[model samples]
Target: MSEGSAVHQWLCWGALYLLAARVALSSETRRPCPQSCHCNSVLQEVNCSDGQLTTVPNSLPQNTKLLNLTHNKMKTLVHWQFQSLPQLLDLDLSDNIMALIEVEAFLGLERLITLRLARNHLKIIPVGVFAGLPELKLLDISSNEILVFLDFTFRDLTALQFFKAADNDLVFISHQAFTGLTSLQELHLDGCNLTAVPTEALTQLSGLRSLHFHQLGLATLQNYSFRQLEHLKELVITSWRWLETLSGNSLFGLNLTSLTIRHCNLRAVPYIPLHHLVYLVYLDLSFNPITDIHRNLLGELLRLQELHLVGGSLLRIEIGAFKGLAHFKLLNVSRNLLTTLEVGAFHSVDTLKTLGLDNNPLACDCRLLWAVPRRLYLDFRGNPPTCTTSDQLQGRYFLDFTESELPGLLTCRQPRILNRRPREVRVDQGHTVGVYCVAEGDPLPSVTWISPQLKPLSSIGRIRALSNGSLEVRYAQPQDSGAYLCVASNAAGNDSLPVSLHVRAFPLSSEKHFRLKGWFAFPSASPGLSGKQNIPFDVKTLMVAATIGFLSFFSSVSVCFIFMFFWSKSRGQIKHTATIAYVPRSAVSSSNGGKGNYMETSRFTMKLI
Candidate 1:
């Protein structure tokens, strides 16, 4: 009980009391989980899914990293509802009936990386609703009734990388709506009511790599619609029924590697500015109304690896159609109206690996023989093409024919006029006139033109015979007004058509004449033409035709003889008729401990064990 001992004891007691107070304060600061929620402190997660709660739960764990309030009946996100959870990394309020989000809803969640408000009833997002989530990388406000995106709506979400606002009633988006999303890589705006490309709005996403705008109400894409998206690599635009024309340069400056535009009403493939898409690798233009695969249509796609033209109205594939696709791998031209395939149509695609030509009306003639060598790489399993031209080969699979049968079957077809020439053509003096003629034969008919004076006319000057057998006459005069003859001859036969040209004097007006010249300067003609008098048949030509006919007939007879011989030999080799006999198994088993039974038939013997 000395003075020093009393002082020491008092100091020790004071220290112990302060330590106890600190422990109590720490315990008071720790928050308890709400009654409807499930908290896992070890994993720092709080889940209140399907709780049917009308309001956001309070007293959430402060250190929670993930908070899921999905399938709740919460109507709104009030200001600072989750302010206490500053360490939150993910917040999912999806499948809720939330219709409104206050400006300061996420006021203090600066460390949040993901926020999902999908499947909610939100009609509009306030400008500062996501103001405090600076580190957010993904935001999904999809499946809502959002009608418009105002300017700077996401101005505070600079770090956002993936954003999905699909399945919304969005009809308009301000030009600066995505001004702050510099780091955005993927944006999905599918199933929106957008009628046109949001070019101005997309200009803000300079670093975006993938964009999805499918199932929209867009009608057309004007030039340079996506010119500002230089870094974009993948673009998907499918199920646009109203979309018809894609203007040249619409995708001019993009470096897209994969582009999908299917199930649209486009009559032809868009003339994409391919010079900018040097890195393009995959392209899909399926389920469109494109009628023809013209030469050089995809010439500039040198790096293209796959092309899809399935379910289209493609009637013809001209020679050199796939001209510049050096690295082309797969070509899908199935389910089209392709009746003839020209030789060397895919000559430029030396690297082609797979070709799909099923579900097409293919004329199994010599023209299709070009694919015989590459048949190993072709896929015809989905409705194999049947012969449509030759009567003997009709309804038979093209792949069933032997190499020897092809030459005779193909050469037997005679030359015929596929496109008839107009009887006459009238044009004003100083204007242009054109005549075309198209023919089809086994050897591909050779076209010749005869002048009015019964002299042969070769392609020269303004009058030239195009490769497609169309004749063009520029600056028509009185002398040019005469009958022109187009003769197409092959080894099988010859066809001649005549077209009369009449030129009328132009009016005495310099302005009108000049306008006519400008307008008719490049008058194009379809493949056809005509004249009087067939060319004199030479003995050499006749002999060659006769030889071809004889050889074809001889080959066909030889094949028939060989088939008959094999059939007769097969009949003679079959000596016995097949018959089945049965006996009781118990009787046979009694001799072998029920291990087996035996039966004898006329053609064979069998034993059951």
Candidate 2:
């Protein structure tokens, strides 16, 4: 052989010789227990850790209450080897290859209370494996390769307190698998292959306090999956991709304290009542496909503290959805597809503290901050959104925008429409008053108002323009009570259809005399508040007549004075000319007060002759 091969051979021989010597020494001392299983007579305990022991030793100390046979190559529990240890209280067969357990494997250990079979290759639990252990309190069968569960797997274990079957390949669990486990406090069935758990499956566990059945690779959950487990405190029945049967009323009678249902395929999370679960404080339904939200669904969960809806595809939220959740503290809706929420969506959750909505296609409106209008613990670290019109949201923190402002703070789309023009009309309620109606026409029409008596109220109303400047009308008292007809003439002089109207007198207080039943009193401009009126003037007319008489008397005197002055001037011309003085008719009239202010004077021109 080569030098390297020769050296490796020597090393292998030396190791085997040392191992044989140790086993021989242990056998010579009358201890059939393997050399790896250390023994202590004082404590009466044996620890066989990390070995290839074929079976547990039968000659162990009668006082041994604790035996740890961990990490061994034991294929099956040997009754003859372990039946003599009557005081054994803890037996740990974890990390072993005990694939097919015989029914009487644990036959003689009547004092066994705690058994650990974790990390084993157990396919199915035999009914006799736990047949005689009446006082067993905790049994851990987690991380096993269990595929099928026969009925009555735990039927006779009446005192079973804690059972753990986590991380197993359990596919089909018979209804009787947990038949008589009444005292079971906590049961874990996480990471199994359950597609749809029947409601009656958990109905048998009367004293169960908490149950976790998560990540069961489920697609559908029936209504009866959690039918009768009234004493359950915390439940995690969510995260089945096809689990969609749970509406707001699924878990009706249970008094659960905390519940989780995350990472499921529900497009909408219906509101489920939690009144019976008065002590429920923690609730998680995150990562579901929930999109619809019914109003006032969370009101009954008065004591719920934590709620998770992470990774859900929830889109729309309604008003008053969280109407009276007084004790809620933490809420998680991370990685969801929620696009919109009303401004008052969660206002009624009076004490909610923490909320998470990160990594979602948040409609990214400036108003997302409304999700936490008050000071709150929000975990929207990084979510994607695009509002190309805005500069404030350019790569900054989404909460920087949501928190800096409010929910729905994002910009909304707007549109523009045309404005309508106002119209005017003229009304004359006199004998010729008229009413008219009109529509678009090639030529103007001659519309008129008529009384029911067949007499035309006003000829002008026949051509009055409408309020829209497209019609005209006249009116009489009685015909005005009904709609007036308007005829539109076409380019060919053909009359067009008349637009119909249900017209009556404009309601006025003055028209209360025309009151009809059921209608309000006619609206009227307050009387004396809308017009200009005149008063009687006979006394003023008489005063004017008296003043005119006084003025005329003065007028006649003044005229005579002027004429006398002229005659005197003529005399001064020494009889050269005949002087004439005359009194006009107005002077006589003025003396009898015929007019206004007049002059009165005497002629005193110097006559030298």
Candidate 3:
């Protein structure tokens, strides 16, 4: 993957080189070559990149100002090619099959600003290769197969702003290679296969602002490689896999806004906070094979907004791991095999808005939710909610469940209030007696009832629940002999037990005694065929029964009146004199958590005394 990405990077750089060459060559004038070479005088510039020319084109018309011949079949720079063109301002001969250059190759042109000689098949460049281009601002001679270079290769450039000499087989870059440039802004010398760069190789640019020295294929970097860059805004330095020690001295005075280190094989990152870079926003330390990242190692970056921690092979996430950060917006710890997110791992991220958990084979078991407890309201835009049963999260993208979807798996239990429901049997005329114990459920269960006398009753009375979980006959007649049933239900199903009742024939003993007394004691009365004595009334039994029933009726009337008066006094409360024990706190416990916390409005308590 790394090699393929590098090849793609080279392709992009090749396109950029073509564009720069085309834009800079627009201000130049071109004419016909002296030797039967073709010329396009329509456009002012002459571009001959990747051609089969042998020597420099000493064409006619000295008014030519630009000449680009990158990647051509040329071997040496002839003296006659330099003697002809004195008005040239830009010259490019990059990626050519050139082997050597004569001392008198570039004798005259002193007004050049941009020069490119990259990707050539040269072993060495002579001392005075660019000694005449005094006004050069940008120079790129990268990707050459040069093993060693001369000292005075670039001695006259005083207005240089950017320089790149990367991907060369350069084993050494002399200290006097950049002696005259004082205004360098961005410099890159990466992938040069260098072992060491002398401190004086880059110490001359007094106003250098940005430096890059990545992929040098070195096992170590000289500690003084960045000794002179005091105004740098970005820095990236990476070595081979064996480079384990990144000393604190290597980052002595730089307070760069962006810093990246790859393939360092780091074991730890010590407390080295860059002081003056208040704008430092990004830090990436990838591909290191690190085992741990200590808490708050980058704690001093008050404005660091994003952190990417990929390919580190991290194994543990400790508590306070992200404490004291004020502006870290997005964090990606993806592509790792972390088995657990330890306790308090993100306990102090007050401002973090996004967290990535992709490419990790995290367990989606019941216990994993105990670690995070609940999902926060933060933006979980791209994070996938994992499922236990399938690899494809079952097409549930960012889906979340409320209390209904999770019961014991979410630390929730159904209310036991429904368990103690009294049996209710509703009796209608044509409908069979149905006794169902309807209970609110975390999961609802089916219920049923039973009755006998398969024929339907025409005059069914209003059903009332029996206190003993059974139904009783409010009024019974000879035809009312039957069985009634009450059922209790559960999640599996419901079952009921039958209750039997028998109606026996009642005797008429009172009528027989009254008839005997009337026949024996009294003859036919003259007034109205009365042949019996007058029967005496049972006044004692009747008076006692009447007195008891009257007292009960009076007591019920007084209670009803009192309740009605108080019900009108209350605003939103309905008072009832319950026959069960009522400690108000226990009643309120059903509303709060299991903690039994209660809250009362500061209104008058119209509670029943």
Candidate 4:
């Protein structure tokens, strides 16, 4: 065997031998109990609680495994206080007046695993007070007057797994206060004076799995509040009355499996943050002011199994509000303002096991028929749902009716036309008209209009069937003048109302005479005669015709002028002017190199015919 392998084998055997020796020594060792304490030999326990002792008791058995000295008046824990009890595994000093614990107080306790200092008057924990406890796994200092945690306060407790510091007047925690707690998994910081999360301090505990925050003065959970807590699996935040907004990315890097947020002043669900928790299994959002669940808000939570939204002001659940939740099992929405539960709100309820709908004023109607058939498979917690409305079924249990009676109990009201009397409507040709009819029913009625020509009028073109059971006809003509029928129908029954419409036609013979007079009327007609009485000619029509005739004559004259001007100019003769030039004799002599400077004058004239 190699040298390294030999040494490992030797160490394993040595650890086994040492464990056996310690057990043998503990079973054989025995000592007399102190006057103020009780000892159990078989269990190796020492209980000195409620003794009111001012100091640690002497004569403790060396093999004691559990030591409890709670409810005492011990003011200090000095060095080597538990040096004699090497095998002690648990020590509880709760309900004491201990104000100080000197360094090296637990120096020799190498195997100690649990220590509780709850309900004490301790305001400060000295550094290195828990340095030698390498195997310590749980430490609780709750219900104290501790105001702050200094840096490296718990650096030596490398194996600590759970730490509780609740119910303290803690104002601050240094960034490196929990620097060496690598194995810490659970932490509770309830009822503190912190205004925000101490993200830097908590990031040192890389293995943390659960965290709780309660009764804080925070108004908002800001973005990236728990950014780097990658292994955290459960989070609880409650009793924050001032909390209003939970930002969209507050839980950015966490993979929490369970989340609870209750007893806050939130007016709406924080859907932006919740959509990121695709692996979430349980969620509780109870006791808020939320009134409705909108569609697609919880659709991304595919693995969600239980949802609790109780004791809120919830009034409605919109259609497909729980879409994409395939594995959902339980939904508790009791004590709300919901009057009816519609089956179309959920994507699928095949996997639902328990449902809570008690304490709501649900009206017993056909809307609840879908849940009645699934009652055999669903478990209704608390009180069974009872009807508070419907004159015949009020104060009756939902499940009391038999399958045969359900058909009669869950019936819809037939559609009834509010206006049943035939009416007459007169409209001028080329004008618009509307025929009116209204309906009332359990389920709203759909309106259809049949025209005078026996054709259904759709809401597409000139003729339209309006939303409120009214028919509108645009540019009414003679063909549109007849009796029109408006039909309103639903699943229960149908109703119809007739309306007589008359479209006034123009006077054709008078119109022809008026046109002929407008074109051939003589200007010698009497000036005092009224156009409508004598001439049947309109002054506005005459002015319009005169304006058109003037514009046409002006346009023709302008075109003829432009063409004649261009033609005359093209046929005219061209003329050019003559040019004459005189050059000096000195200039000619310069051109001749000054040889002939005497009297040389030149004149030239050019012209074109």
Candidate 5:
């Protein structure tokens, strides 16, 4: 027989064996049911929930495997209350308003596997209350008035695997609170009043695999926070308002495969700290104010498969941000401030099976044309990515445009000069002068200055065009006094603006102004020898000239500073040093992945206590 067939037959045989055992146990006898309670002999279960009983029923069925006393008025469990029911496997005493339990309350129920004491007024648990429940695997004492957990609080639950103590006023935990829980795997401590991660107490769970924390007052995750949790596989944190920092060494010793940090006050990604998580496969950092994903920040995690950054202020994802992630399959960046997705942002789009770009105000242009052929993988089943501010494709969806129609639907906007208003500059001979011209466009058009002589100005001599597209003239002379043009051009088109410059000669003391004006105004003209006019020096003229000169100097200095600022910033940009993995095209489509809505909120929720 084939291996698959053999396994299927084995499973069928196991099911039949379990059914036969249950039937034989049910045929033995029918036990008596206590008053105000329901009993099922076939299932060996007793349910006394919502019965308003004041105490445990002493007449419970002896062979019962499940006992539910939830929603009762029992104030306490007396010593040896369940001694007669040795076969009980599940015991629920939740919402019972039970405030106390004797040290020997669960004396003889040695086979119990699940115990719940949630939503009660219990303030403490005696040391020996759980001394005999050796087979217990799950315990819940959440939503209570418990202030602290004493030493060896759960010393007898050696087989425990899951423990929930959420929504409690837990202020302190003894170092030995979980002394005997050797088999524990998952522990939830959300909504507690603790100041930080209880590292000292968590080291006791050597076999722990998953941990969760939320709504704590921790401001930072210090270095080596979980250094000793060697076997941890997953870690989740949420709703921590004061949490803003994750130290570089915080996750040094962990080999986690999944990590989630949402609804926190983080302004940027903790790249240094995440570098050691080389085995990570899933990362979710939603609802934070992370403005940029600089290159090389996340490339170290080569095993990463999925990344989600929704509802954030993400402005840019630099080139090579996902360079080393060979197995990456999905990327969700919805509801962000991303204007365009650069083509070089990923190593190769071929490996991606699902892409989420919904709810973002995308600028439809050639930058997004690369994604047209991959529309089948864009995850457009729900709300596809739409253009909100593009000149031509606004209110249109990316999936609606085919590869051939991209040239028409996604277009480049022509460059347009911003400062088109003509302004005339008047400076004394040998003084400096600067004319400013700004423009806006797609593809970022380049600027060129045209001299009055109709010659293109270069950065060679006393005249130059600042990197910010402004023209400057040093040691101004009569030849430089004329209309200067500024032209901005890109692949789409070009725009030009004309500005006039006047270099006046110093007037003789005896020369008089033909047209005098107010102190704040410039004189219209002056008596001259032919077309060349001269003006006498005065406080008003000097002030005007000084003001004009200062403006030119300030403009040149400001534009030059802006150019250098951006130049330095670009030079300091980081690049990923990790080597990228290249898989065959056949492997790309064969890889497994999960599809999900980009704009959807987290689905993780706690059980109501």
Candidate 6:
């Protein structure tokens, strides 16, 4: 054997040994699985849920695609925990006690597409923790203790399509936090402490389709809050305790399909620029305090299909309130304070399929006849609308009223005396007298008078019935001094009142003359001076007899007139006053030869002194 051949054999043997050792080490590192974890080589998956592990295992399969470490005791994520697994497509570390994530913790995960670190104790995310993940498409950090989103937090995640940070302690997000998420389609920040919409952060995600901010601390939605998000399709914002106003342009520049803003303590239907949302199909503004629906409130929303305004403080729907909503299919106005709905309120909505007006106080009179014909499209399945007015229609369903029954039910109100005629009237003889009776009813009542002559008085000689149901008596006499009845009658019923008239006579003057010759001649005149008695006597004798007769007559008449005048002057009597009786026209005309005229005239006597 030569010395050179021996040296070559030894060097070759040493090289072979080193190569075998490397192979053995590599094989050993890939064989063993983490404790209490299941590894399926065929599927390239590892599940370590509820394992009580404190950290990620060091000896994971390099080709593993799905890793789940949920419900574990892992406290922190050091840099590059899965550095050896470049083919990892999905990683879930949810429900872990992870409080910190070191910078570059996911540095080597170039092919990672989905990452979930939800329900953890992480309070902050380092700026570059998710950097270099160009292929990452979905990330969920929900239900965590993250307090703020720094600028460029997701700047490098350009290909991310779905991101959820809901139910976190996030109070602030920088304008550039979501700057590079051009492909993001859905974003959720519900159950967070945000005080305003992340408008600046959302502008970068022009392709966003759905957004959720439910259970937030936001107070108002300013104008153009969602401006430039032309491709947004659906938005949900519910249960905001302080949210009050939504500016008219808050939803501008968006092509939304569905919107929900319920339980936000809003006072009215937020003034949304409906013209801009031409493609909107469903809108929910329930649980608000809106009072009325004015005409054209939902103007020209031609494509709108469903509208929800339930559980509000609505009172009225003005005429033509829902104009230009020709395609409306479902309308919910249930559980409100609506009392009246005007005619043609829903005239423009020819395609209405479901009209929910339950649990309201509707008038249910002729005014509701507009809806009775359309009852087929109404939804009274839950607590039908009840009538709030009309005595005969009260407590009845508006749909049950028929067209003919409505008119009768509407005219059932009895005649009510809005103003009554005077109970007592005083008028001087030969003066005009008038009395008015005013009343109100569904069908205006006709008024007539029962005169002092006990007749049903119409326009006759000096008496006339005015157009306004007033009684006018021209040249009232002392005979018109009794109770007059003013009767008002209508379809419902009749009402009447009694008015007493006192006709005062003309006062006598103190300078009136007294009669002397008539007082003496009344006693001197015989009962029957049948024949003419001729007195034959001389002039002197006749003169003496005449003088004696004149003396005797003058003495008796003067004494009688003096006594009567003094008696009348001392008594203060009203001899011209007279009592009048009121009787029905039927009774008066029969007794007075069908003339119904009974006028009593007073006579005045003139005496010469």
lDDT per residue as tens, model 4, 1-609: 999999999999999999999999766776689888999989999999998899998789998999999999999999989999999999999999989999989989999999999999989887889979999999999999999899999999999999999999999988999899999999999899997899889888789999999889899999888877999999999989998889888989989899999988888888998898988999998998889889888998889999899999998887788999988899899988887777767778788888898888877777788878888778888567788767788888877889999999977788898967768999988899877788898656678999878899888898788877788989887677888888887556788888899988755465434444455546645343223423455557878999999999999999999987787679787555576678886777676785554655677777643
Off by over 4 Å in 6: 1-33, 39-44, 272-275, 339-343, 361-609
Query: 1-609 in candidate 6: lDDT tens per residue?
Result: 799999999999999999999999888767577877999999999999999999998888888899999999999889877798888999999999999998888989999999999999989998888976889999999999999999888888999999999899988888888888899999998898777788888887889999988798778888888988888999988889788887778787888889888888788666455567778899998887778777776776668888888998987777677677777778788888976555467745557777777778765554555567777666655555677655667788866776777666643357676656468889998899998877776545668888767788886667777778888878876667888888887545788888888888665443343333333423433223212233223456657989999999999999999998888788785375545455666665566775556644434454422
- Report the Cα RMSD per candidate: 31.0, 33.5, 33.4, 16.2, 28.5, 27.9
Candidate 4 stretches greater than 4 Å from native: 1-29, 412-609
User: If candidate 3 were superposed on the true structure by all CA atoms, what would the RMSD be?
Assistant: 33.4
User: Predictions ranked by lDDT, top down?
Assistant: 4, 5, 1, 6, 2, 3
In terms of TM-score, how similar is model 6 to the real structure? Answer: 0.58
**Local accuracy of candidate 5 as per-residue lDDT tens digits, 136-184:** 9999998898888899988988999999998888888888998988999
TM-score of 5: 0.67
Candidate 2, backbone clash total:
56
Tell me the number of clashing residue pairs for each predicted model. 13, 56, 6, 0, 0, 2
State which candidate has the highest lDDT.
4
Name every residue pair that clashes in candidate 3.
Answer: 33-59, 34-59, 522-531, 523-531, 524-531, 525-530
Candidate 2 displacement at residue 270 in angstroms: 3.2
Q: Answer with 2 or 3, whichever has the higher lDDT.
A: 2
lDDT of 6 at 462: 78
Q: What lDDT tens digits, residue by residue, belong to model 2 across residues 1-609?
A: 999999999999999999999999766754454476788777767898886777776566666888999998889865444777788889899998878778777777778899999998988887766777888899999999898677888876788899999888887888777788888989988788866674555777888888888677655554446767878887876556666656545677678878877667766554544545667788777766677567777777788777777666766566677667766666666665665444566744446556565555444453444554443344333342333324545444443554345433554432211122222333434234323344342222234333334354443444344444244443423233343333433222433232333334443454223223444454434333323132223445656977897789889998989998788887664553444455566676777685655644333344333
Can you write out model 3's per-residue Cα lDDT over 1-609, one digit (the tens) per residue? 699999999999999999999877854654445443434454445676655777776554575567778767887876535666676677788868777877646667766677777777778877766566667788887887887656766665678889987787878878777677677888887877676655677777667787877676555554556776778778776655666665556666666778877667666543453433456787777777766667755566777787666767876565556565667776666666664453345534556666665555554433244324335554544674444333433333334644455443423123222445333333322233323244433223223334464432222454344433434444334344456554544322344445454544243355333333544565545323223355533556657989999999999999999987887777566554444444466456665755645654332333464
Is candidate 1 or 2 superior in lDDT? 1
Candidate 5 residue pairs in clash (backbone atoms < 3 Å): none
**Candidate 5 lDDT score relative to the true structure:** 0.84
- lDDT for 107 in candidate 6 is 86
Candidate 1 on 306-404: residue-level lDDT in tens? 889999999887778878777877888888998776656775544767777777877666666666766655665455567766677888876676778
